[model samples]
Target chain A: MKKYVKKAFIDTLPIMAGYIVLGIGFGVVLKSAGYGLGWALAMSVFIFAGSMQYAMVGLLTGGASFLTIAITTFLVNARHLFYGMSMIEKYKDAGARKPYLIFALSDETYSLVCNSDEGRDYYLLVSMFDQIYWIIGSVIGSLLGAIIPFNTEGIDFSLTALFIVVYTDQWLNTKNHVSAIIGIVASVVCLVLCGSDKFLIPAMISIMVLLFVMKKFCIKEEE
Target chain B: MNWYAVIAIAISALVTVSLRAVPFVAFRGNKQLPAFVDYLGKTLPYAIMGMLVIFCLKSTSFALTRGWAPQLIAGALVVVTYVWKKSTILSIVAGTACYMVLIQIVFR
Candidate 1:
C-alpha cells in the first residue's frame, strides 16, 4: 500500500502542480464573488470539477434558473461522457472504490488513470492525492484572496485561456479540423443570434447535429 | 449561500457525476457500446472542446472600443504559446497575463 501510494504520488506530481494552481484560481474567483473559505471548500469538495465549477460561479452570480444551471453543467462537462466511455474497461474491477473513482474522475485524473496499467489501489491513490492538492490549494487561495489587497480585475480570463489552450492542443493533435471548425462556427453563430445569456444550449445542439451530419456524410473520413 | 445556490451546486455535482458514471452503468461488462456511441466517444471531445473555446469567448463585448482586442490578442497569444511551448500551464499563464494587462492597463 505504501508502495502504491508513493507510486501514485510520484506519477501525479505534474497533476498536483496543475490542480493546485487552478484550484487557487477557483478559490480567488469564489472569494471575489463574496464567498469565503467555507464556500470554496464546499465547491472543491462537492463539485470537484475544474471548468464547470468556474462556470458555476457565473451561473450562480447571474441567478440562472435551476434548469439552466443543470443544462449548462451538462454542456460544460459533456467531454467527461467521452472520458468515461474510454475508462469503462480500466475501472471495471475497481469494485467498492469504483463509485468514488467515477465521481473523482476529473479531466486531469482521467488523463493519468486512463494511461496507467497500475491496479485499483494505485488509481484510487492518484485520484485521492490529486483531490487533496486541489482542496488544499483552494483553501490557501481563499485565505490569500481575503487578505490580499491587489487588483485582480480580469483574472477570470484564466478560464478563457484554459479553454483556448485545450482547444489548440486538440486541434494540433487531431488530423481533421472539420468538427473543430464546425464547433467554433456554430457556437459563434448561436452566440450572435441567441445572445450570451441564452447561447449554450443552442450551441451544444448545433454542435451535436453538425457532428452527426459529418459522421453520416464522411463515413470513412481519415479515422 | 442561499438554498438556491446550494441546490444549484448539488445539481452541478450530481449531473457531473452522472455523466462520468453513464458508461460504467450502461456497459456493465464486455458488452459493446453501439457504433454511433463509440464514434461519439472518439469524435465528440474535439468538437466539444472547440465549442467550449467559443463558449468562453461568447461574452466578448463588441460594442466597446477595442473590446475585441483583448480577447483576440490574448487568444492568439495562447495559440502561439501553446504551439511553441506545448505546455498547458505556460500557455494559460502567458495568455492570461496578456489578457490581464490588455484589459486592466492597455485597453482600460
Candidate 2:
C-alpha cells in the first residue's frame, strides 16, 4: 500500500505538470469571464474536464441553453463510453475506492492509468493525485488571474500543447504503429469530409472498426 | 449558460463516476470479468487513443495549416521523429519548430 501511494505520486508528476499550465489558463479565462475564484475552484473540483471546462467559459458568458450544454458535453465527452468500457475489469476490483476512480476519470488520469505498469494498484493513486493537482492549479490560477493582469492571448495553446505531448508519448511507447497511423489517416479524412462541426464521431467510428478488423485479420494470420 | 454549465458539470461528473464505479461495486470481491466484456476491455485503449489523437490535431492552430505543403512537411517530421526514437517533448518541439520554420519563415 505504501509503495502504491508512492508510485501513484510519481506517475502523477507529468499530469500535474500539464495540469498546472492548463488549469492556470482555465483559471485566467474563467476569471476574465467574470467568474470569481470560488467558481473556478468549484468548477475544478466538480467539472474537472479540461477542454470542456475551457468551453464552459463560452457557455457561461453567452447564456446558452441547458439542453444545448448537455448535448454538447455528451458529444465532447462521448469517447468516455469507450474508455469506461475498457476499464470495467480494472475498476471491478477497486472495492471502496471504486466510486472515486470513476469520478476522477479525466483524460490525464485515464492516460496515466492506461499507460501505467500493469497489475499495480497505481491507478487509484494516480487518480487521486491527478485530481488534487488539477484542483490546486485551478484555484491558484483563478486567484492569480484576479490579482495579476498579464495578457492571456495565447494561453489556449497550452491545452493543445498538452494533448500533443500525451499523443506523442503514446505514439512513442506503442510497439505497433498500425493503430497510430490508422488514427491519423481516419481522423484527417473525416475532418475533410465532415468539417469540424461533426468530424469526431464519424472518425472515431471508422477508426474503431478499422482497428477491430486489423486485430481479427492480423491475429488470425499470425496464428 | 452559466447556470446550465454549472449544472452540467455537476451532473456529468456524477454520471461518469457512476459508470466507472458500477463494475467495481458489482464485482468488489471478484477478479474476473465475463469473457466478451473482458476481450472488449483489452482492446478499448487503442480505440480511445485513436480518437484522442484525432481530437488533438483538430484543435491545433490554423497558423500551422497555411497550405498542404507545410502541414505535410511537419506531419512527416513528427511521424519520423516519433517512430525513429520515442520522445514526447522532442516530437512536439520538432513538430512545432518545423511548422514555425515552414509557415512563418520559409513560406512567408
Candidate 3:
C-alpha cells in the first residue's frame, strides 16, 4: 500500500503541477463572481470538472436556467462517456473503489490512469491525490482572489489564453482538421444567427449535426 | 441563489458521473463498441476544443474583439509562446501579464 501510494504520488506530480494552477484559476474566477470559499470547496469536491467549472462561473453569474446548466454540463463532459469505454476493462476489478475511480477521472487523471498498469489501489490513490491537489489549489486561489489588491481589470483574459494553449496543442498533434473546422464554423454561424446569449445550444446542435454528417470524412483520417 | 448554486453543482456532478459510468453499466462481456461511439470519441474532443476556443474568445476584449489592440497583441503572444515553448502555464501567464500591462499602462 505504501509502495503504491508513493508510485501514485510520483506519477501524479505532473498533473498536480497543472491542476493546481488551473484550479487556482477556477477559484479566482469564482471569487471574482462573488462566491466565497465554501463555494470553491464545494465545486472542487463535487463538480471536479475543470473547464466546465470555469464555464460554470459564467453561467452562475449570468443567472442561467437549470436546463441550460444541465445541457451545458453534459455537452462539455461528453468526452467522459468515451473515456468510460476504455476504462471498462481496466476498472472491472476495481470493486468498491470503482465508483470513486470513475467519478474522479478528470482529463489529467485519465491521462495517467490509462497508461498505468497497476491495480485498483494505485488508480484510487492517484485519483485521490489529484483531487486533493485541485482542492488545495482552488481554496488558495479563492483566498488570494479575495485579498489581492491589484488592478485585475483584464484578468478574465487568462481563461481565453488557457483555452488557446490547449487548442494550439491539439491542432499541432492531430492530422484531422475536418472536425475542428466543423466545430468552429458551426459555432460561428450559430453565434451570428442566435447571438451570444442563445448561441450555445444552437452551436452544440450544429456541431453534432455536422460531425455526424461528415463522420466518414473524419473516420477516414483515423484509418 | 445559494440553493440554485448548490443545485447546479449537484446536477453537474450527477451528469458528469453518469457519463463516466455509461460504459460500465451498459456494456459488458466482450461486447463490441459501436463505430459511431468510437468515432465520436476520436473526433469530438478536437471538435469540442475548437468550439471551446471560440466560446472562450467570444466577445472578449482581447483577440481583436471590437478592435481591442492590446488584447489582440496579448492573444497572439500567447499562441506564439505556446507554439514555441509548449508550456501551458508559461503561455497563459505571459499572455495574461501582457494584457494587464497593455490595459494598465502601455495602451492606457
Candidate 4:
C-alpha cells in the first residue's frame, strides 16, 4: 500500500503542474461566466475532463437541453470509446474498483495509468491521486476566482496550452510519427472539407480508419 | 445556485465518477489483458491527443487561415522539439514561447 501510494504521488508530479494552470483557467472562466466558485468546484470535481469541462460552461450557459449536453459530451468524449476499449482486458476483474478507474480515465490519468509499469491496483491508485490533483487545483482555483477582482482575460487558453503539451509529449515518446501525422492531416482535411460543426466526429473516424489501415498494411510491411 | 443546476451538476459528476470507477472494479484480479485490448491501449493515447489538438485549434478565436497560422506552426514546432528531446517541460515552454513571439511579431 505504501509503495502504491508512492507510485501514485510520483506519477502525479507533472500532472499537478498541468492541473494548477488548467484548473485556474477553468475557475477564471466559470467566474467570468457568473457561476461563482461553487460551480467551478462542482465542475472540477465531477466533470473532470479538462477540455470538455471548459466547453461545458458554454453548454450550460447557452441553456442547452440535457439531451443536447449529453450528446455533446458523448461526441466530445467519444475518443473515450477507444480509451475504454483499450482498458477492457486489463480491467476485466478489478471487482468493486473497476468502475471508478474507468471514470477517472481523463487525458492525464489515462496517460499515466495506461503507461504504468506498476501493478494494476497501483495504476488505479495513481489515477486516483492524479484526480485528487485536479480536484485540489479546481477547488483552489474556484476559491481564488471568487476572491480575485480582475477580469481573467485570456485565461481559458490554458486548455490550448495543455493540448499542445499532450500532443508534443505523445510525438516525443512514440517510435514513429505515423499516427500523429495521420491525425493532423486527417483533422486539417476534415476541418477544411466538413467545417467546424461537422468536423470532429468525421476527423476522428477518418483518422481512426487511416491509422487502422496503415497499421495493417504499411507498418506491418516495414516490421 | 439554482436547485436544478446543482442537481444537474451532481448527476453529471455521478455519471462521470461511475465511468472512472468501472476499471477498478472490473479488473480486480486480472494480470494480463487480451491481444486486441492491448493494441488499443497503444493507440488510444495518440487518438486522444489528436482529438484534443483538433479541438483546440478549431475553438480558438483565431480565423483558421490567418490568425491561427502561427499557432499551427508553433504547435508543429513543439511536436518536433518533443520528438527530438523527449522533454515535456522543454517542449511546452518552447511551444508557448514560439506562439507568444509569433503573436507579438506577426499577428500583432
Candidate 5:
C-alpha cells in the first residue's frame, strides 16, 4: 500500500505543478467575479472538471440559462466519452473503488493511468492525490487572490499552452494524420461559422462525423 | 449561492459524470464494444487534443488592431521548442512565460 501510494505520488508530480497553477487561475477568476472561497471549494470538489470549471466562471458571470450551461458542459466534456471508452477494460475489475475512479477521471489523470503499468490500487491513489492537489491549490489561490495585487490579464492562457504542448507531443508521436487534420479543419470551420461562443458543440459533432466517414471510406480504399 | 448558480453546477456535474460513466455502464457483463467504437477510442484522443488547441485560441482575433501577434509568436515558439526538445514541462512553461511576458510587458 505504501509503495503504491508513493509511486502514484511520484507519477503525479508533473500534474501537481500544472494543476496548482491552473487551479490558482480558476480560483483567482472566481474571486474576481465576486465568488469566495466556499464557492471555489464546492466547485472543485463537486464539479471537479478543470476545463468546465473555467468555462463555468464565464457562464456564472454571464448569468446563462440552465439549459445553456448543461449543453455547454456536455460539449466541453464530450471528450471524456472517449476517455471512458478507452479505460473500460482496465477499470472493469477495479472492485469497489471503480465508482470513484470513474468520477475522478480528469484528462491528466486519464493520460497518466492510460500510459502507466501500475495496478488498480496505484491508479486510485493517483486519482485521489491529483484531486487533493487541485482542491488545495484552489483554496490557496482564492486566499491569495484576496491579498495579492499582481497582474493576471492573460494568465488563463496557461490552459491553452498546456493543450498546445499536448497536441504537439501527440502529433509527433502518431503516424496517422487523418484524425488530427480532421480535428483542426472541423474546429476551424465551426469557429468561423458558429463563432467562439457557439463553436464547441458544432466542432465536436463535426469531428465525430468526419472521423466516422474517413474511417469508412479511407480505410476501405487502403484495403 | 443563487438558484441559477446551484442549478448550473448540478447540471454540469451530472452531465460530466454521465459522460465519464457511459462506457463503464454500457460495457458491463462481458459485453463487447463494436469495432467502430473501439476505433474511435483509439483515434479520438489525437483529434480531441487538436480540437482543444483550436478551442484555446478561440479568443484570439485575427484582426490587426486586436493584436494577436504575441499569442501567435509565443505559440510558434512553444511548437518549435516541443518539437526540438520533446519536454512537456519545459515547453509548457516556456510558452506560458513567453505569453505572460508578452501580454504584460511587450504587448501592453
Candidate 6:
C-alpha cells in the first residue's frame, strides 16, 4: 500500500504543477466574476472538469440556464467517454474504488491512469491527490486574488501549454495521422461556422461520425 | 451559494460523472466492444488531444497580430522544448513562463 501510494504521488507530480496553476487561474477568474471562495471550492470539488470549470465561470456570469450549462458540460467532457471506454477492462475489478475512480477521471487523471500498470489503489491515490492539489490551488487563488497586486493576465496559457505539450508528444508517437487530421479539420471548420462558444459539440459529433464512416469503408474495402 | 449556481454546478457534476461512467455501465458483463469501437478507443486519444489544442487556442484571433503572436510563439516553444527535452514538466513550465512574461512584459 505504501509503495502504491508513493508511486502514485511520484507519478502525479507533473499534474500537480499543471493543476495547481490552472486551478489558481480558475479561482482568480471566479473571484473576478464576483464569486467567492465557496463557489470555487464547490466547483473544484464537484464539477472538477478543469476546462469546463473555467467555461462555467462564463456561464455563471452570463446567467446561462441550467440546461444550457448541463448540455455544454456534456459536450466539453464527451471525450471522457472515450477515456472510460479505454479503461473499462482496467477498472473492471476496481471494486469499492470504482465509483471514485470514475468520478475523478479528469483529463490529467485519464492520461495518467490510461497507460498505468499499477494497482487500483494506486490509481485511486493518484486521482485523490490530483483533486487535492486542484482544491488547494483554487482556495489559495481565491484568497490571493484580493491580496496580490501583480498582473495575472496570461497565466491561463499554462493550460494551453500543457495541452500543446501533450499533443506534440502524442503526434510524435503515433503512426496514424488520419484521425488527428480529421479532428483538426473538423474542429477548425466548426469553429469558423458555429463560433468558438458553440463549436465543441459540433466538432465532437463530426469527428465521431467521420471516424465511424471511415472505419466502415476501410473494413468493406478489406473484405 | 445562489440557487442558479447550485443548480448549474449540480448539473455539470451530473453530466460529467455520467459521461465518465457511461462506458463502464454500457459495457457491463463480458461483452466485447465492436471492432470499430475498439479502433476508436485506440485512435481517439491522439485526435482528441489535437482537438483540445485547437480548443485552447479558440479564443485567440490570428487577425489581431498582437492577439495570436504570444500564444503561437509560446505554443511553438512548448512543442519544440518537449520534442527536444522529452520532459513534459519542463516544456509546459517553460512555455507557460514564456507566455506570462510576454503578455505581462513584452506585449504590454
Q: Among these predicted structures, which one has the highest TM-score?
A: 6
Q: lDDT per residue, candidate 2, B1-108, as tens digits?
A: 456657766765555455445544554455566654565565556556655656755644455445445555766676677667665455555765676566666766
Task: Give the winner by lDDT: 4 or 6.
Answer: 6
Residue pairs with clashing backbones, model 6: none
C-alpha lDDT of candidate 2 relative to the true structure: 0.66
A1-223, model 3: which lDDT tens digit per residue?
6889888887665557567667777888899999989999999999888878998999999999999999999887876775676677678788899989989987667655655578889999999999999999899889988455556656666666766666677778767778878878887888778776567677777877888898778766563
Candidate 4: tens digits of C-alpha lDDT, residues A1-223: 6778875775566667667667777776777777877787778767778767887788777877777766666666665565676667565656677656777778667665555457678867877877777777776766676565644433333345556667666655566667667777888788878887678789878876876677764243221
Model 6, residue A65: C-alpha shift (Å) = 4.3
A41-92: candidate 2 lDDT, tens digit per residue: 8887877788778877887688876677666666666666666767776666
Give TM-score values for chain A, per-prediction: 0.69, 0.83, 0.69, 0.78, 0.77, 0.80
For residue A30, what is the lDDT in candidate 1?
A: 86
Instruction: Tell me the DockQ of each model, to 2 decimals.
Output: 0.54, 0.33, 0.49, 0.37, 0.63, 0.66
lDDT of 5 by residue, B7-106 (tens): 7888999999999999888877856777876677667776777787888788888766236887898899889998999876677678878888888888
lDDT of 3 at A166: 66
- Residue pairs in collision within model 2: A63-B1
Model 1, span B1-108: residue lDDT tens:
489878998999899999888888887765676776667656666666666677668778879955788989989998999899888778777877888898899999
Error in Å for residue B104 of model 6: 2.0
RMSD per candidate (Å) reads 4.8, 4.5, 5.4, 4.4, 3.5, 3.4
Per-structure clash totals for the candidates: 0, 1, 0, 32, 0, 0
lDDT score for residue B77 of model 1? 93
Task: Report the C-alpha lDDT of model 5 over A1-223, residue by residue, as the tens digit.
Answer: 6889877886676678678777888898898998889889989998899989999999999999889999889888887887787787778779999999999999778766765557799889999999998998789888898554666556666666667777777767666678878888999999999998889788888988998888854243221
- Per-residue lDDT of B22 in model 4: 47
TM-score of each: 0.73, 0.75, 0.67, 0.75, 0.83, 0.86
- Per lDDT, the best of the predicted structures is 6
* CA lDDT scores, all candidates in order: 0.79, 0.66, 0.78, 0.66, 0.81, 0.82
TM-score for chain B considered on its own, for each of the candidates: 0.78, 0.59, 0.63, 0.68, 0.82, 0.86
Ranking by DockQ: 6, 5, 1, 3, 4, 2
- Per-residue lDDT tens digits for candidate 6, residues A18-99, read 7877788888889999998999999999878998999899999999988899888988888788778778777878999999
Q: Which stretches of candidate 1 lie over 4 Å from their true place?
A: A1-36, A49-97, A106-130, A141-145, A216-223, B1-12
Interface RMSD in Å per candidate, to 1 decimal?
3.6, 4.0, 4.2, 3.5, 2.4, 2.2
